[model samples]
Target: DRYFPSSKLCSSCGSIKKDLKLKDRIYKCSCGLNINRDYNASINLSRYELAI
Candidate 1:
């Protein structure tokens, strides 16, 4: 079971959730960050390219 639910933690705002209901498709953080369920999870495993 390789399930991942990192959406509960917002990378942009670093918001961590204690318990995320399965019925919730939307993620709301106290930092005022809003994102879709899938999108939010993707962000956790996502990274961008940058040059030094």
Candidate 2:
């Protein structure tokens, strides 16, 4: 989905980081989730479910 926030969304806590920039290579969540941005996005993509 075009609106799916794969990179900006925290995979651990499901919170969206609206200010995330392309330069940000690490995904840090307020819930203490610290991971690589690409890895985090991949994890989120793997768990994505289409809302049909």
Those runs of model 1 whose alpha carbons end farther than 4 Å from true positions after fitting are 1-5, 48-52
lDDT of each: 0.69, 0.92
1-52: candidate 2 lDDT, tens digit per residue: 8789999999998999999999999998999999999999988888886433
Candidate 2 deviant stretches above 4 angstroms = 49-52
What local lDDT does model 2 show for residue 51?
36
lDDT of 1: 0.69
What is the C-alpha lDDT profile of model 1 across 24-47, one tens digit per residue?
888878888777877887767563
Span of 10 residues, lowest total lDDT, candidate 1: 43-52
Candidate 2: residue 15 Cα off by (Å):
0.3
Q: For each candidate, C-alpha RMSD in Å?
A: 4.6, 1.7
